[model samples]
Target: MRPGLTIGEFATVTHLSVRTLRRYHESGLLEPAWTDDFTGYRYYTAEQIPTAQVIHRLRQLDVPLAEVETVLSADDPRRREEVISGHLRRLEAELDRTRAAVVSLQRLLHPDPADLAVELRSVPTRTVAAVKGVVKQDDSLSWYDAAMAELDAAFPADERTGAPGGRYDNELFTHGAGMFTVFRPVRRPRATGRVEVLDLPGVDLAVTVHAGRHDDIDVTYGRLGTWVVTHALAVDGPIHETYLVGPRDTPDAAEWRTEIGWPVFRLATGTPERAAADRRR
Candidate 1:
């Protein structure tokens, strides 16, 4: 007998089988402390019991064999900590995605059709203090910030406000790069630098309030477009998004509200009654 247990005794202590212990030995995962030359038997020392327990626990946690080997072989505490921390970060990211999916599903189940607040109204001609520039699609967000800053710096929004407006060119939507504008109400039209003050002629718009982050707001646009089509309206102007509350005003992404406006005209050739009938079908 060695100083401690035989393979069978060690397996009993660890709640593992003799066959599993042998396999572990064969795989060089947990080698025996000593080998009997005469009898060709395996013997493990008392000290090896704790090492076996660690391997068992790690396996239960579903850690890969290679990773387990690396962790076990690493003597440095910092290196092991780094490996565990990396896995934790990945798990946290997955948890966030799972939570977002849950929120989306809940909204689908108890959907409030009215919760998507939409209003159709006519906006009259107005002079707006504006900033316009050519912007790439990838740079749209930055351009929006710069344009808003310029507007605020020029003629900040006050109690006396007209329609907050934006005009994006077709290329901005189709080819992903073109002109953009941000404007607030002004008394007179004029031009300053790339910023051009202009009159926004009267038009009807289907406006919807999106009460959440900018991400996934496209779903709201889709809903509003369907509403317009069913109401016998044809989209005639560039899509405009006016920021009601932004990240700068409230750091919480949950509280962000943006108003999406799509300009439309009465479908010239179509009758509202016919459109309503088609919508029913």
Candidate 2:
């Protein structure tokens, strides 16, 4: 019988815990080269050390066990690389989320009043090319991407009259699913595929510019809502957002500027206290 290193000896050489080795075996990720019939002791060959190291590295990166198995089981080098690259991309996205969360937390702790600013403006009626769909709150970003891409491709820069904008139904925020509409003011509206020409009615709006990433956009919305309730009565309408500068304009997220607009009416004959009370009801 060709003798191999015991689990303990293998763990020592691989710098992996014996418990981890056992877990890897139980998960069918890395099985031992031999097992004693009487004692049931597990042993691994020196040749398997590199495989163990690879598994260890993947685990260190917090790759799911199933994905690790897929990566290791793949016979083609390109297939293995594709699997690993996919996981790495996911890790990069997670890192971005974490960084955004940290920045948001810092802002919450500091509580800067100057970060928020609200204004009132009257928008003129315009004919636009738009895409509308029912989208889940979680899927809003990707839906926006697809909708905006369609709009951009349908109308060239010369045809575009103004910045691209979106209108989100209140149900989206209140019920987690609702209609999302993206529009672009065109020199002349033309229907193409999912894009359709439509006239947007004008309305007075309480507007605010939300600068940078949307990770904490809810804070800006809260501030705008407060301003609307205090100075004006919020009317029945979807929330509007004009993308003054966006991903299509600049790759740098810090340079992005979005104008948030809440439709409203001037509060008629009431103190701020009464308006606040009425809004609460």
| Best-fitting candidate, scored by lDDT | 2
7-125 per-residue lDDT for model 2 (tens digits): 99999999999999999999999999999899999989999999999999999999999999999899999999999999999999999889878877877787785745666677888
TM-score per candidate: 0.54, 0.84
- Candidate lDDT scores, in order, read 0.73, 0.89
TM-score of 1: 0.54
Local error of candidate 1 at residue 75 (angstroms) = 25
Q: Which stretches of candidate 1 lie over 4 Å from their true place?
A: 1-115, 156-163, 188-190, 267-281
**Candidate 1 pairs with clashing backbones:** none
Look at candidate 1 and tell me the lDDT of residue 26.
84
Model 2 stretches astray by more than 4 angstroms: 1-9, 35-42, 89-97, 266-281
lDDT per residue (tens digit) for residues 1-281 in model 1: 34558888999999988998887788778899888899878889888888898778766666677776777788998997777667667777677767766766666576665745666667677777788878898898788888767666666445226545577776897899988877877655566665676766777677898888765565676678887776766555777777777775789988887888877664333554664456455
Angstrom error of the Cα, residue 77, model 1: value is 22
- Candidate 1 lDDT trough over 10 residues, lowest sum: 266-275
